[model samples]
Target chain A: MKITFAYWGNYTIAFISLFQKLGINVIPPEKTNQQSIIEGAKISPEMYCFPLKANIGNYLTAIKKGADTVFMVTSLSGSCRLRYYGIIQDKVLSEAGYKVNFVILNQNFIDIYQKLKKISGASFWQIVKAVYFFFKKLHLIEKLEKKAQYLRPREKIKGQTDQILRETFPQLEKVRNLRELTKLKREIKKKISEIEIDSKKNVPRIGIIGEIFTVTDGAINFGIEEKLGKQDIEVHREMDVTYHLKKIICPWKDWQIQKKINPYLKSTVGGHGRDAIFEMLNYTKNNFDGIIHLLPFGCMPEVVIRPILEKIHQETGIPFLSLSLDEQVAEAGINTRLEAFVDVVKNHYNNKNH
Target chain B: MKCYLGIDVGSVSTNLVLIDKENNVLFSLYIRTEGDPISAIKKGLKLLKEKIPENAEVVGVGTTGSARQLAGVITGADLIKNEITAHARGVAHFIPDVKTIIEIGGQDSKIIILENGVVVDFGLNLLCAAGTGSFLDAQSFRLKIPIQEFGKLALSSKQPTIISSRCTVFAESDMIHKQQIGHKTEDIVAGLCQGLARNFLANIAKGKNIKPPIVFEGGVSENLGMRKAFEEALKEKVIIPKYNTVMGAFGAALLVKEMSPQKSKFFGFGVIDKDIKCTSFQCKGCPNQCEVIEARIDGKVMARWGDRCGKWSNLNMNNI
Candidate 1:
């Protein structure tokens, strides 16, 4: 079966490698753009979350490119609307007269393996190796991204880190084995480190915590991470595809997040609501200058947690900027808010020092 | 006779203020932007030259507001700050103990929370125009009431009517419906003020710790009715500083005074006569398609910005 999945930053590369290793035909969704969002929103319900619309758009674009089967990661139980996205997306697609099969995977490892076995006819050991390769690449990409975040704000030349990262992603795709991957990792690290960065520049450090999709998707968030980096603010984002996968594979992380956020939030609000609070608290304790919470318009979990985050801000005296984004959100509006926010944080820092 | 110049180029109005070494306002001018910020700054500078003392020399310059970058480039400002910081600085200079600042301008409204003369938090209206000064101005025009008399009419009402300020369209329709019901004009005006104040409090000041010693500044603060509405809504007295309309410009001037940069980037008031031109084009280098803006002075490119990749911006750096 020809399969396709939505893009989540560079995570698509790992997915392609895994599917290729299993000898399955995988059609990656077209790069997200204004056309994709417009197409996705045209058929989607008005109040559905942005990720759903974008994901549906991706599937439609993939289908147009000849993908007959779609793969989606779903949850069985959650207050977040994400769990219901699979059924709604399937219904929406079929109603649009597209005949396609959808393979939905939950947190169950055995269930995913069984589905893959039926689809790809791959040996159990080969499937395991593919999964191993997927994770290894994911970890490597995450490391590279973290390094870029550190270097972007301090780079003597603007956009140098971005330029290096843009070139590194394709190079990562060509790696075949552990030895090759390690060598490439070192080479990319050296290349990124070689980018000249001003050592004396004292930049305000910002931590971004929010919904997974909006946090990872640059197009949707208006490239906020890059915008902050361009403003010479060191932005550290904790949510990524690999981080989400790790939490899914190991449920103990959720327990720890729950415990840390227990005093503020009594129960899970579902999705990343609990996790957002945990991450904000973590950043606050670590002496980060500011916390930016990004959520899609009408996201229930995030909406529920916003006030709590504000309360944390009041209690800690650390500035918190909550940006709710929709397709209608203007780039100028975002830029102005970010500029004002950066000013507030910098002024606060300067005042504290004096 | 050394002076520091501050220019605030907002969407609705462009304000310029000049201050001396003692931070006393030497001269101030407020003019309608009319959608042309460069021309507005030039006109303001011309007026400044005519009004200021003959011997006064501009030693430092600062720019603030939405068009700060454009103004900074044209004026060669020593510092370019956002309206939030500028407004807060301007007010904190006058009211050092202010804990909250409610600034409602023509196109946007913001709430800045301060502590001990430092900004701790701020919120700006996003994609909403209901609680801003332009909305009130538009309503005044629709009602055939002079904009200057709007506040007086609102204050005279004994019982304000209830108007829905959730959206501008809804509020206009609601006002018409109230008028049809034979409600007095003053009552409707007061109700609109209350609705706007409520909207500002609900959205911009939502979940904010608005304490005492709140200073309200901006063009909208000139309306006593809106100030009363805010007072009634927050159940706390709000102080409107003397220079409410030009607070942003005043703040910018104060910030530059505080910094007192060793080398001022002021290009002098002669920039008012220079032939400055700005052009924009979309860059096709990547998918972002950033609209690169270029500013030219006397037909020579001085600055290029708005590119996401910094490709064009780097080129302008060499020119500088």
Candidate 2:
């Protein structure tokens, strides 16, 4: 293992494949596990957001497996801890006596593959091709998840939709170009369309808006979307790698969203904090039955937005379930809260329809 | 008479309830779980067996609480539900117009807001038990008073001391400082109740509508001091059901009845005599390393769970 990137669901493999195209041997991160979380927590400051600790866990594990370089995700925006995580993590890693090369890339990799160019010293055309491949593959993964979310709640069999995700995500990792990606997309849509579904099932729609990592990484949030799907709830998440990429490609989009959030939030508090308010209001306007806000415990930006989320809930009257999670939370406890949220959402949905 | 049975296997206590066709609770028991829900459930079922008429049949059985899944498998429950849903239904069963429910259990607490007999919102104490029954239990032991009489003693305070209840440890230390500084024990106890009520309303019930017909249930309802503190803080009356301690089981029974299963799957009182064993393993098939739990009765596996992937949980454990 020469280097490893912060694992982001299917996108983890996409990152690895992108770098592998550049002749960098990066092991796909071992899916975030208890061992990694524990390993990460042992060295991390107690109150650091879960994603940071998890990254530490992944890097330490990768180092143990002979990964000599750490390709870390960071930001230049100083509004959140994300901008400084690379520096802090670099210090911590060096202090731990692990001599490793650090390649810090902003999360909006599409607009800034220049960092990769600088590191790999690759030709501009070569870097552009690798970035395009990574972006295309990421978009396809997002599409698969969207289709699965829709079908999951209505599938006649509980696990059929899941079976598709479980089997197809790996097949997606093998996709090399736009042609193969298109073919896989069509086949996935065909498979999903073929899944036996009762379209008339009374499913409540929920919008999930939160910190990117906790929302995107299923392991950290305990696959909350799947849990909701099992209970006949349609989950629509607006925060993902693609969403971030689009926002980065178009800078003015933030200004538009910031305008909507101005009354609720004085300014962009950084990260998804502002995006969450925008998403909640969006969900309310769309008549979503509820919204679930996921944030790592004590995450400053997300935590600050919590009260604003509550205010929005009060004004909009759409039910809201806010879950601040870390390793301290048990899956059983999360399941119970989700069950309760669904029950409430279902009741609210039914009453409105009648 | 045919009756529905509800078994609630919680962290601190196990409750069992028997309700007739008309929703009349015929038998109810609240016993200490004592860290062994299996044995506590068996004890409740044995006691129920002894009390019921010989010709009476258990038409349905339901389970709820933290250990609901475990209890459901052991008792062959027709419906297994979360405690929040069960408690809401239980309260609405008595007070159909119930707008709010404040339930404080042994290890956790919850605030449920209901509108028109349907739950609209709810919250559970996420991190740990801060303001709950366990804290009060520990306090009563330190005071050398029976837990049963703690609430009554608290009600006797003339000038309740001011205390903090944000964290249990902090609250305990605050209570001792008050006690050493010439505060009466009764006053300190009353302050603890008030602090708990304020914490509950502020944290778990934060920003929710506090409407009337609010019902308080669970083991903590027996603590009269808690009710007073709630009533004082809300400036509205708080109602407790007749079988408050067993409300979780009562609601579960009512829900199973509503499901109207064609046949009951209850193991009956015979489960009391069965030897049930629970075992767990860390699965290495995938990177997740799910800790799968299996329950067996007399060497025959009945059910398995706790796996994120369905591989282990979906396996026919009976065959294994």
Candidate 3:
């Protein structure tokens, strides 16, 4: 059965490989862009959060390219909001007239054993091997992505990180042994460390804080981090696999961190939006030149976060910017804003130097 | 001789609570935000300065809320907390036996489930504004009644109508339909409160077990109408703390009192009254229209923020 599966971002590469090992055709959503977001948003409910629209866009884009199935994973316990996204997305896609099949993989429905049986249709031994192989590659990719973060900051050449990522991700699919995966990780780490970082000039140190999906995933956020990289600006974003892992284990840490930092401005659970506001304030007090806050459009946490951020910027005498992305985000507009910010930073740098 | 100050600066209100060396609130003030948090905070500080004795030395200051960071910077807070921890702390402190906390503030509502003083599971309603104080404010405006009087009006109802509260627009239209049907104003007001309560339960409380001693707090805690509605919906009695309105601030203040300060980096009281000017520009950083805002005090840049990239976050400090 030419069962083709599609997923959203770089993390899914390992997921794709496991299915591929089981003789399944796996495809990553084509590099996401502004048009895709708009196209997806046009079909999605206007009130749905931004990541929902972007994911819908990814699936729609895949289905349009002849991919039959899309996968959505969920958590059964913490944060019901995230759990509902998969079901909602399925209904939303069906409403949009895309009759493609959705393979929902949530902790609520399928256990680890059942998932292995359903997806691979293999005996216990075969399933164990496949699972083991998948984790080996998964661990490698996770390490690579982390190392990539450190390396990404070093690369002076524009799109060097992008080019390297594109080449390295696909090579993971060919890994049949643990040694190959281990070798791949070590080489990638070494190469990444060698990438030169231009740290002589002082750059603004901005911190990003927001919802997990929209913040880390580039397609939903419209290539925000990459764009910042081009401006030769050091970006200090905390959203990644590590943060998501933390959310799963120590769910209240997000709030605890908020509690730790926010008392200076507001004393209440302001939500993630409030956390972002505090982070921005921290950045400002620490002498960060600017802070960027991003969320999916109509996102509830950000709604609370936005006004406070506006208030924080107003009160503390700090430079802050906000972007809300749904499927309809325009890349050109985003790029324009980035260029203006870079120009402003450059102007400040020039002024300071003279 | 040493005292502490805790401030909770929210979108709709700014709260200040002065804790004595013993963690007791000596003087507390709650001010309506009125679309200007800085002004509200400044006014809060001014009120704090006047109310407290100068000899009661402020040993530590804590800040929390949506505006905690800005508040921390302004107040020189020694400790800061998110509203959840602060609110949870407030509930745990006042009502030691409390199991669940239902907090409906100006812009959002949350249900914190606690088991023996530790938070087990919690739910926050982020998508809908059906249960928030702002929603009640809008409903009050539509009904041509003061927001403070909404609970009183609901209490007077004999036969309450059931208004659809799935969406605010739908709820408004349903309310108008009920009015046309000649339902008593008090009944309709009661229905509005019930609708908000139902909406909140349906959205955030699906399948979650909510037990007592339930503490209802935040700005909306003052609404007897909503409180009654919650009781009817949950079929259990809800408790409201004495200083319910500023619980998050109080909780945050309590947190600061509990924790030893690393150091007081507070900018001092003089900074609160400064003529700070804030300006924003659309960041042309990539295709993201990040509105980078800059804060200036006395014609010098005091801080810069509002960009996704740290492109300009912490680079300049010529005493700015």
Candidate 4:
């Protein structure tokens, strides 16, 4: 079996599972780790964002594990550096002397279908089944993540909620249909509802917003949601696979966000610059305690939108903390910032109620 | 007599401060951390053991700074806080109406904005630690002037030269170039101070409503030259608080005092006598291959940390 795979993130299960159903010998990419990062960083541009570096790391590891072909998803002209991610990685991999087949999914529907047809030798009907299953699994993954987010701080035992998520994720890969998902959903919901919780606990709620990759991928942002949840802060974020799918299926949602963001962001600078403002407004309107903006070191959209975020913070008087992540980010620094941010939000929440 | 102890373990220095129940700073000691926070903390405790009255019982303990976690573990701290909160808390204790806090420490600098005695927002040095205390320490070493005198000399120069404030490398290189061209030492020093002040404003203080009366507290605030440069730039006078150098420790004391735990978790002066050691190694159990660090006291593990999986961190301790 010639192994084929893509890099990992919130979309890993969806991407790998879809390929698996097509009879491709797919080895799931390993979790982002130190060895892979050091290898990837050595061969990549010094200033590449953490996501790109992480992808390169995973690709190198995939090749080491005897992967013969790889496919990756990319955006086109998001006014962000993401447009060039696949091209740059392909060049870097070729230079490193890898002979594996490479594929880039730039959202050209017919081209993607044709590529799949060529690679898998599957009929049009088969590819359709695989892709439809992909959307369903993506929705399931996001729903599971959202449930875990809600239950983490409220769980009876410290690691109980995360343990549920840990158990359910792999089981999801084997699920065949909406009926199975519904059965799994009921079983999980029963377990969650049965878990003891202090419904009266008044934990400060915080919204996580900013760059999609960093927000979606826990390893890169150092498991911020987990850390915040552990601190007795209820964490909420709207930038998941389903929300992004909505942006793609109904770009009117983005245009609506862009319209609201125009006073702050004159035009789309790519990769969720407009969505960031719209989300910030959403959190504020909902009377959330605080908002944390996670910006990858030199990300164009994030850097450009920083001042606007600050202005909103000033006018709104909501405690906002901007955390920038890079390869050199130390866990201790993020820990310190989060601890202080919790204090700020709790204080703000208390003041509002009084 | 009873007291609350606040210990701040930082990269360059460790500060221990004692405060009364009334929240008045009673005794404060600032000493070089010297790369080993354990010894520095013990030494601080030893000196403190000698000075404080025999009847002075430590009823509460707080820890803050970069090594706050380690210090909290060693001291049995009832309260642990970050530098920003500690600095703000300490400043608000003295000047209740202060609106902004500008703190520059050994390795980091931050601008904290407060409204009504509570910190509302803050900004830490991003991308670069260009003009922090360590940056000043380096310039002073290269210039062959005492750090204490670096600021004094800068205060003497009327016309400060212009130097790039983009980063520490360029700023120091510019200073050396200016010196070789026969620029006065005072002028170059003054120029460096101005550059740092400018950098802090444009970077850390950017978009932060740096309202006065701004309280500047940290090791760097002791530099009179930097103070003058800030005043000239903001066109508003900056006040250096009474306990400028040890404000973080001072604030920790204030926080613990305010929290007022029934009984102190402090290990007492006897902790200085224990044999403490730390060792780290890579765990090959999984692909993450996390580097796990173990802190020990006489071959019994006090703490095991630095692992992504709970397998290591959640393990039961056995004598080793």
Q: Which candidate has the top score in DockQ?
A: 2
Give the better candidate number (1 or 2) by lDDT.
1
Best by TM-score: 2
For all predictions in the order shown, the interface RMSD in Å is 1.8, 1.0, 16.9, 1.8
Tens-digit per-residue lDDT, A1-354, candidate 4 = 465554555678788878877877787787777778778888888877777787888888888888877787788746678888888888888888887777887755666778778878988788888888888888878877887777778876776776677677777767766688788878878877777787787778999999988888877787898888877889999888778767777878877887777777767778888888889988999999999999887788888888888899988998899998877888788888888888899899999999
Q: In candidate 2, which residue ranges exceed 4 Å CA deviation?
A: A107-112, A175-190
Residues B12-80, model 1: lDDT tens digits: 999999999998998888889999999999999999988989889888899999999899998899999
| Candidates in order: C-alpha RMSD to true structure | 2.6, 1.8, 15.8, 2.1
Q: Which candidate leads in lDDT? A: 1
TM-score of chain B of 4: 0.95
Task: Sort the candidates on lDDT, descending order.
Answer: 1, 2, 4, 3
Q: Which segments of model 3 are wrong by more than 4 Å? A: A1-142, A146-354, B281-293, B304-311, B314-320
lDDT of 2: 0.86
Tens digit per residue, CA lDDT, model 3, A237-278? 666654555555575876676675554445433335545655
Alpha-carbon TM-score of each model against the true structure? 0.93, 0.97, 0.58, 0.96
Reference-based lDDT, each prediction: 0.88, 0.86, 0.70, 0.84
On the 0 to 100 scale, the lDDT of residue A5 in model 3 is 36
Q: What is the lDDT of residue A335 in candidate 2?
A: 89
Q: Write the per-residue lDDT of candidate 4 for residues B100-203, one digit (tens) a residue.
A: 99999898999999999999988888668786988889899999999999889999998889989788899888988999999999998899899999999998
In model 1, the clashing pairs are: none
